[model samples]
Target: MRRPLLSEALLDTIRSRAGGYDASNTFPHEDLADLTAAGYLRAFVPVERGGAGLTLREVAREQMRLAAAAPATALAVNMHLVVTGLAAIQADRGETALDFVLDDAARGEVYAFGNSEAGNDLVMFDSRTRAEPQADGSYRYTGTKIFTSLSPVWTRLATFGRDDTDPDAPLLVHAVVARDAEGIEVLDDWDVLGMRATQSCTTVLTGVRAPADRVHRRLPAGPSGDLFMFSLFAAFEILLAAVYTGIGRRAVELGVAASHRRTSMKNGGRTYAQDPDIRWKVAEAAIVQDGVEIQVESLARDVDELVDHGPLWFPKLVGIKVRAVEGARYVVDQALRVSGGASYGSSGELGRLYRDVLAGIFHPSDEESAHATVANAYLGPLER
Candidate 1:
């Protein structure tokens, strides 16, 4: 694997500040600045665009490494990476629609994903936001978006909405809106149980404007079969799974360390590492974490190699995400068990990890959606 851009010292600083950030309900500005200085934000852009030119698979490995240092920071950075990755994926496939993103990244502009909305079950297929077309060929987007990661620092937000102005082209309009532009408001309300350092606040768009030139795609509303959708799903799911896998790996390591340190009074001063039950629990967590790691690497490699699985691709991608998330939860639980009651303190590292792992359940390709996608792949569509 290629060397990671984030150094151990930088990662340690980020990790050290994570608890304070979470406690204060603040964003990790220092961590972001360090990462930006490292040019980690442009890792997905082509080398010609002044980036590291890393492939999706390589970037996934890097993300996993970063997550092990600080999961919330990794999760927040994942949004920017996903948007840039989508642009890279399309550009590599001969699409000029997202060239502006590459150009902007090369110029050191930060991007954020503002695609999520409350109660939008169709996900990328449709939208609850309204996209009103202008006479000058621009668009006005109006809606509220939830979980807007990097809310405080993004220079541009890649957003989407529905445009039913043209009957034949009832479209899902995609565009990039400037962060400081009119009609955009980032509410300071991001308190949560975990991943608090992300500061994914609620963003209200009264009528944010995107110039005609900034608009990229206008797919027919509802479950698009376009390259944009493919890139979005593939990059988002794989990168997300990588984060959880890293969390699981960290949890296993912590469990082992705790076992080696704690002594078993009942066993005549023997350490917990010599206790059968503690050893079993640690082994169980390791086994599950290893499985998730392998799956993350495999699917990421498939994406980079363009290995065609056809209809099975979506199921496989979603399946890997679900497996990674659920596996992380289980592994973390077992680790806590092996580490004993000391891990239960809310301020402890293990305690924070438990909270961070729970946020995985809320990410895209959720448990229900993943299972449905897999079922549809093997059993065909349900009868209407």
Candidate 2:
């Protein structure tokens, strides 16, 4: 009897506006406003802090529902959720280091993940950006981050850079930089093939100063078993999987509806739902979508319940992300196939879904890296 996170009317409004936003290649400012008014931005902040206090699992389910309505909006919001969710998770476990993040979110500040670099394959483990220590304890970062979602309106950007000041003890400095801080430039160069509403523009940082207090962690250049790292991976991977799973679910629904609406010429104008081949395609897509949904929900639940997977945590996280993304891609492709030639049109919902789902592969834990992580976890490192 619990109420839905996104009401049907709000979802319908968001869905109706999606095509216009995607077609115009503009950020969904209206969608953001609507979501913000619904308190979606602070879903993870503790209720005592004037927020929803939703668990990660609840938020993940909400994200799936949002993505089904407007994927770009959902994906962009996912970045903010990742930051806030990380802080909430850490705080829930008695770590107060990131309590400021939750506080800021509760106070109406928006955050974005500005950690992605153009050529850095190591992801959170390493950074191509340079972090120089200042006379005080603060650090100045200089580098460019690509695919920075919520670029247009994010107030704080969570990013990291490498500090080689001490070559023998190099560190990856993680910090949250205020968007209006001096020496930070957000470029309007987000033109892309998909996820147009994300406005994930390129961010150029030239000595952007992060006050010492805002600088969170300084871990070694490579992977480390830090709580912050675990929180980040858990929130990011699970929520990201949720978004793609939602996309696959929507695609399956679209395919089924299309089958019922389209008539087959060869069978006396009978609906495609009567065509065995179309039905089979719909069934196949539904099966894959079902598995992806289950995997995402299960992983989110485990994280919420604090299930001890130990070393397998990373493998499980990356595995679900890869599976959900790939499965979504397949489901969208199948949906496009069964929807007939009209779906090939640029304005068609399936066409947009097809484009948006492609952005999944480009997210962190790419297929190559996910495989390598799993391989190392199972077979051990390759002879050092």
Candidate 3:
């Protein structure tokens, strides 16, 4: 077998601290620090640039491994990896738009995805923020972004907005801003039911400036078949799915352990592990997790190998995300049923897994969007 990309000891340490961080509702700063020091943050960067240069598929599998140890930590780190992964995709294809991202990653600058909005159904196709263009080719972005993971530690934030000042009305402007730049405020309001350790606080961008060099791409409003867009969607969805799938894997493991440790009084000292119902639940959860694992691995590999799905890629990508997330939910729920009341406690590992899996529902191309994408792919766009 090949050696794991991350050290087992490191993951064990992260797993040990996950509960404490989650209980305190604090960001996994220690995990981030350790990962940064160990260069896991640069896994997607080129080896020539002082990074591991892991392929998208390798990184996705590693994320699944990391998430099994610490869900919130892996989820938070996914934001940084997503940015770097997208840059790596572009660099691999000979694009220069993400050169600055590569340079910054080599210099140990952690990146965060800050493009999500509170009420914007447009997702990445459009933005609610304002990008006021400057004479020097820079832009000042003013808006609010929700779910800014790694909010406390990220050095650079990749953001986007609408440039309505142009007569065209909806230019999708993209830029990367420094976290400490003026007009940037990180609100300490990340109180949530699950994935609490991510500290994905709300960010208020009040005229935050992105200089000309950092401003990467500008496109017309609505989705496009751009390579960069594909990279972003692919990386984001695959890694995000990997995280929840890991949660499901962990839940299944916990359920199995619980079943073995728990004795059934009705069976005269027999373990729950011997109970037919418990066994069935465990098997169901295991099957769901296995299905997601396969989908995540296959899709990630296809992306790395540049398999031409053409117009079908969007539906396929979104389909994996939806399947992985929903499959995880099923696995966790079944695992909880197998483990019984012990998992009901908020501090229990299974309970934490339950809450963490719920967050997968909120990621991009959510149930409605994903279904619409698939429906449109088969039925064609709807008429007004």
Candidate 4:
């Protein structure tokens, strides 16, 4: 299939100042502006709501290309898209959120998802982040969530937590909190190894009142109420795959360009690419990326099919996500290895690729619950 133009454009921008960006640890604001102008936000948002309304499969493909160009930016943007998809799914809340997102895009308002909590028992969903119901059905949210990406620039946040009462609610509500809410603070505490531009700072919630409409499903809002956990969770896999693919491609491309200039060990004058061993290594990187693309494509298709069928095929999505993340790591590692010491050099492109790929392992996207879903799908049917 032909590559998308968005990927090429973003890559061009990234390449222009990649070394400087990484060295300075700066967000690709220009690239983000371009992406926004290019209607990338609408790429995953619903078409009915002024977005491109691309299918699940198409969304994956598009995001893969975008991520390959700038993984950190792509990933940070995925946070918004995930929440947008969640907003798209809720009939009552979905339309309203989409309208606001469209306005934000029109007004150039950036957003990010803030879901993880600090010191609140994430396991039990104890979510110390409490939201007390107030008069007129509004809620006053209080708690601190760390690792909130793209703040200051982010005008909005999509957060998840249990209600003041009824932890066993039929659904888990995802609320949208404005940045200027009465008692919220955006803390700068992100010290990540890679994808540094993500700006994953901490966002504190203290006595911030969110109206009922802005509050998606209230506490006791069961887990199954939001398919976004499954949808964008699946889409994030595509993003992960794309990030490594881009890194691998850049590494191989740079390696090929540099290898020809290097003297070969086998012969006094032969260059690295001229030697069989180095040529094989470079070729292997290409082969690995090709394989990963196929896997990502298959997963996207499975997800799209599930969207049409509904519920029964969720297991396949989870499995594909696990495999995609694994594929991304493997692909990038091979590319880095083939590129050799140049990849590790402070000035080289490969060094950045190494850091970006490492971020995948630490991302909360690869949680144990998702892994268990894959296991359950494969093993749960055995007793039957």
Q: Could you tell me every candidate's TM-score relative to the true structure?
A: 0.98, 0.98, 0.98, 0.83
In order, candidate lDDTs are 0.90, 0.93, 0.91, 0.63
Runs of candidate 4 with Cα error greater than 4 angstroms are: 1-10, 46-48, 88-107, 118-126, 167-171, 219-228, 305-314, 367-369, 381-384
lDDT digits (tens) for residues 1-384 of candidate 3: 235568989999999999999999998888988998888888888888888879988998889989999999999999999999999888877887997898898899989899999899989998889999999999999999999999899899999999997666579999999977999999999999899999999999999999999999998889898988998999999999999888888888898999999998899999999999889999888988998899999999998888989889999989999999999999989988988887899988888888998999999989999999989899999999
**Global fold similarity of model 2 (TM-score):** 0.98
| Full ranking by TM-score | 2, 3, 1, 4
| Candidate 2 deviant stretches above 4 angstroms | none
Look at candidate 4 and tell me the lDDT of residue 61.
Answer: 68
Residue pairs in clash, model 3: none
Per-residue alpha-carbon lDDT of candidate 2 for residues 202-308, written as tens digits (9 for 90 to 100): 99999999999999999999988899999999999999999998899899999999999999889999999999998899999999999989888888888888889
Global local distance difference test of model 2: 0.93
- Pairs of residues clashing in candidate 4: 47-53, 169-220, 170-220, 170-222, 171-220, 171-221, 171-222, 172-221, 172-222
The 10 consecutive residues of candidate 2 with the worst lDDT sum are 1-10
lDDT of 4 by residue, 56-113 (tens): 4565566666665666776777777666544443323333534555455444556687
Query: Which wins on lDDT, candidate 2 or candidate 4?
Result: 2
lDDT of 1 by residue, 81-121 (tens): 99998888887778889989988988888888998999998
Model 3 RMSD in Å is: 1.1
**Which candidate comes out best when scored by TM-score?**
2
- Predicted structure 4: lDDT: 0.63
lDDT of 2 at 158: 95
